[model samples]
Every structure is written in structure tokens, then in C-alpha cells.
Target: MVQARIGERLGLAPATVSEGVKRLVTEGYVEIRGARDVELTEKGHLIAEALVRRHRLAERMLTDILGMAWHLCHEQAEDWEKVMTPEVEEAILAKLEGEPTCPHGNPIPGTSSGIPWSSLEPVAALDAGAGGVLTRLLEDVELDHDVLKFLEEHGLMPGSHLTVMDTAPDGTILLEVQRAGTNPARVALGRNLADNLWVLPAL
Candidate 1:
């Protein structure tokens, strides 16, 4: 992403983002191309994977064990991940009991998750009458608590089934959401919201 956008998301100033990027470049963790395209190097990718793994694990613990709301787990996990030692991480993994995904259905980097990412597509791309199982949400979805809460209210949690019932010209999608132990719900989703929700289409 561009440095300005990165800083915007991180709530950091331009100078701070530039300095951080410079340090990462110096350490060979990332490289810049074009006018301001910063991309992660192989070394940086590995480190980022590890961090995401830990963060996902923490999110699982918060939502499953601590009973925190799924919408709030991601940001809360940020603080929890910092203090977690290797041993603690292992213990938490053991407690998760072969579950490879967090509350949002995002796979932990080193786990044996069988999710077929290549076959997944956003619900927004499906037309009326298309059906699929909601699989995972994008990382950016976690950045907005309001979006998460709205999804939860509509029963859009992972593993729920979604069917596109109709579409409006204004880019609003009408979806029928089905989850275990509840009646199917008809929810209206904006294009931007549905774009971030990936699904596994039925065969």
C-alpha cells in the first residue's frame, strides 16, 4: 500500500510511517517500487505470517474462552498477542483442539486448515439465486468494528450459509442467511460490505 494509506490506517503521521518504512527497507524486510509502492520482501512475509498467526490465536481465545464478542476480538487480541510467549501460544493452540480458524474463519498461518482459498469468491460477485457458505472475512473487515457488528447482527458469521435472493440497481444485495438453530434471515448488504465477505460456492 501507499505510505499515506498505511499511515491513515495505522493512525500514524506521514513522517512516522516514512521512518518505519525506511527502517524496514534498511533491514531488508521490505522494498519500495514506483513512486511509493512498498511491498514486503520474503523475509518480511515470514515475520508477518508469524505475527498474523499469533494474532488469530489470540482472537480465538478471546471469543471462545473469554466470551468476548467476535466483533471486538480482533482489536482486543492485538494487546494480548504482545505478552504471549511461545509456551503460552502452544498451550492455547492445544486448547483450541484442532480448530484451524479464528472466530472470523481466518486460518492461522501454520495450521492444517483445509480451506480452498482459490475457490472462494466474494458474495458481491454472485448474482441472484447464487448460494454459498460464508467462509472467511478479509483482514480489513476486522479494522471496522461497526462493520463487524452489523455482520453479526445479520447472522453472517463463518460457517453460515448465504444465498443471494435479489439485487438492487444501486448495488445492494439481498441475501438469505441461514445458521444453525435459527430461522433463515433476509439481510440487505451493500456492495462494499459484501465484497469483503468471501464464500465457498456450492457444487
Candidate 2:
């Protein structure tokens, strides 16, 4: 992701993001590939994988153990991930039965069960009347607390069955969620949110 986008996601000032990126580049964690693009180096990838693994595991621990709401796990996991040691991570993994993904359906790195992106399609691309089981929320979407809360409130979590009801001229997708033992509920999602939602089409 670009520095500007990263700053937006983290709610950091532009100067802070620039300085942080510069420090990362100097430390050999990131590389500037183009005028506005940054890529992680091999060393950076390893560190990122460790952080992501711990973060996802932390989310699982929070939701599965403490019964934390799924929408709240991401923020809490941020603090947990930083303090988790390798031993702590292993303990949590064992306690959680080595779950492959976080509460939001994002895969934990090093879990050896990551899903191939090729097998999924963005919800925005689904035709009206088409339906599928929600598979995951994109990482960027997971960072948006409002979006996460909205999705959770509407029962749009992973494994939920949803159908595309209509697409408005403004690119909003009207959807109907098929909750077990209940009548379907209609919800409208904007293009940005819909684009970040991936689904496994009904077979």
C-alpha cells in the first residue's frame, strides 16, 4: 500500500507517515519501487508474517475464549499482537486448536491454510440475484471500525449466506442475508464496502 493510504488507515499525520516510511526504508524493511509505491523486503515480510500470525491468533483467542464481539477483536488484537511472544503465540494456538483464520475470516500467516484469492470474487462483481457464502473481509476493510461494526450488526460475517438483491445506479448493492431460522433481511452496501467483500458462490 502507498504511504498516503497507510496514513489514512492508521489515522496518522502525513509527516509522521513519511518519517516512519523513511525509517523503515533505512532499516531495510521496505523498498520504494515507484513514485508512489512501497513494497516489503524479504526481511520485512518475515516480520510482518509474525505480527499477522500473532494478531489473528489473538483475535481467535479473544472471540473464542473471552467471548469478545467479533467487531471488537481487531482493535484488541492490535495490543495483544505486540506483547505476544513466540511461546505465548504457541500457547494461544494450542488453546484455539490452531484455527486457520481470524474472526473476520482473514487467514493467519504460518498457519499453512491460507485461501487462494483466485478462488473468490468480490461481492461487487456478483450479479443481481446471485448469492454466495461470505468468505472474508479484505484487510483494508477490517481496518475500518465503522465498516466492521456495520457488517457485524447486519450479520455479514464469514459463513453467512447472502444474495445480491439489486444494484443501484450509484453502485450500491442491495443484499438479502439468509439467517438461519429467520426471515431474510435487506441491507444496502456501498461500492467500497462491497468491493472488499469476497464470497464463495453457491454451488
Please count the clashing residue pairs in each candidate, in the order shown.
0, 0
Question: What C-alpha lDDT values do all the predictions have?
Answer: 0.90, 0.88
Put down candidate 2 lDDT per residue, 70-91, tens digits, no spaces: 8999989999999999998888
lDDT of 1 by residue, 82-110 (tens): 77777878988888777569788888878
Error of 1 at 27 (Å): 3.6
Candidate 1 runs further than 4 Å off = none
Candidate 2 residue spans exceeding 4 A from truth: 97-99
Per-residue error (Å), model 1, residue 31: 2.5
Highest lDDT scorer = 1
* Candidate with best TM-score: 1
TM-score of each predicted structure versus truth: 0.93, 0.91
